[model samples]
Target: MELNSAKPGLLCSLEASQSQRTMYPYVTGTSVVALKYKDGILMAADMGGSYGSTLRYKSVERMKPIGKHCLIGASGEISDFQEVLRYLDELTLNDKMCDDGNSLGPKEIHSYLTRVMYNRRNKFDPLWNSLVLGGVKNGQTYLGMVTMIGVNFEDNHIATGFGNHLARPILRDEWREDLSFEDGVKLLEKCMRVLLYRDRSAVNKLQIANITEEGVTISQPYSLRTFWGFSAFINPTPGAQ
Candidate 1:
């Protein structure tokens, strides 16, 4: 009777393992940064994927154009991120085939992705990524973020992963609504430089994309200028053999 509720070992009862009930990411990217300037939105991400503590992929492209006006950037499981892109690709294709001339905007794409990530989490299987969506539609700029848990918010500027920790502070102090495209890029570079110096998972090679009323343009991968003359970086063992 009450023995059914007893401990498993005493009754020789075999308990099933809950190993597959959750998700754990293997290869993951670090962070993504997005901001809104006068003309439109801008985003940046580095090309690096880490396996545990080991560096795995170095040329991964985390920021991508969605539809015609929006750009999406992700920081997390690289494979899962790619799967999200496939979903968007299909969605965009379907919209094109409909010939409605009404494409999915940044807000719409972000909302759709939020649903996807949340649904997967509810199933005990999550995508393990933080996403940034940016675009310019109807002469208005949009910037938003969604986490693996489906948490989301919009702001003039948004960043994911390490960017949230190390870059947001800088952005909060510097980002402005009417920032020029040149200034926006410089600001993003400042944040990325800090990340490159502080975040071990971050790489120096990065891509910056901007979406104006015209369209989206992602820059070629480039590295930032770094100085290692500081004492902390110069010598860990000043007098040691």
Candidate 2:
């Protein structure tokens, strides 16, 4: 997979500020969380794109299924994530053309993505996104993550960006290897809710994807239920904007 240049107009900088240094992301998404359940893998991400402190885009689809079995959830530059999808789609097509019974699963896709990220980093131009790859094949489930710098790892549960900061602690305390599908979705929803409440780049609307031996299932966009009745939310300091 090759890294593409950031999309024109993807960044929300003033025209006067445009320069080589401005090629990096100015609008970005937040966290993505994925975990393994007894049946397979489940992932979730909010639909938000933030430009600096401004909420820029809504209804952006950050989680998508790759080929038939693998699903990917991405956070960071929305343009970079879209570019990564194009690369992965081509890779999967070539693999399909090989006519081999075996295809790239979650593990293989994760490896390919990490190499792409690392290669781009070596060129001093990274993809500017973090990804969660999840899938199940031959009764084995895989859940892994990779960052812009190419750091990669697998866990029963994994999250990127703010999720790494706010969600992983809850996962560490509550995640289980043999979690049921219901429990897994509940856990992910819990994580997403926390992110929506605490992460400024996060939104209440989210999409969840699941991959089992049967194949991939991506849910329609939805919003999480929230309560903002806390004292701090109800009352701010005098003269506070």
lDDT of 2 by residue, 131-178 (tens): 889999889999999999999999889999988989999999999888
lDDT of 1 by residue, 1-241 (tens): 4658878774554433424433678999998988888888889999998998888888999989998889999999988898889999999999899998788888899899899989988887888899899988888788888998899999988888888889999999999888998999999999999999889999899999989988999999999998878776777677653
Alpha-carbon lDDT, every model: 0.88, 0.88
Q: Each prediction's TM-score against the native?
A: 0.87, 0.87
- Give the RMSD in angstroms, all C-alphas superposed, for model 2: 7.0
Clashing pairs in 1: none
lDDT of 2: 0.88
- Stretches of candidate 2 off by over 4 Å are 1-22, 236-241
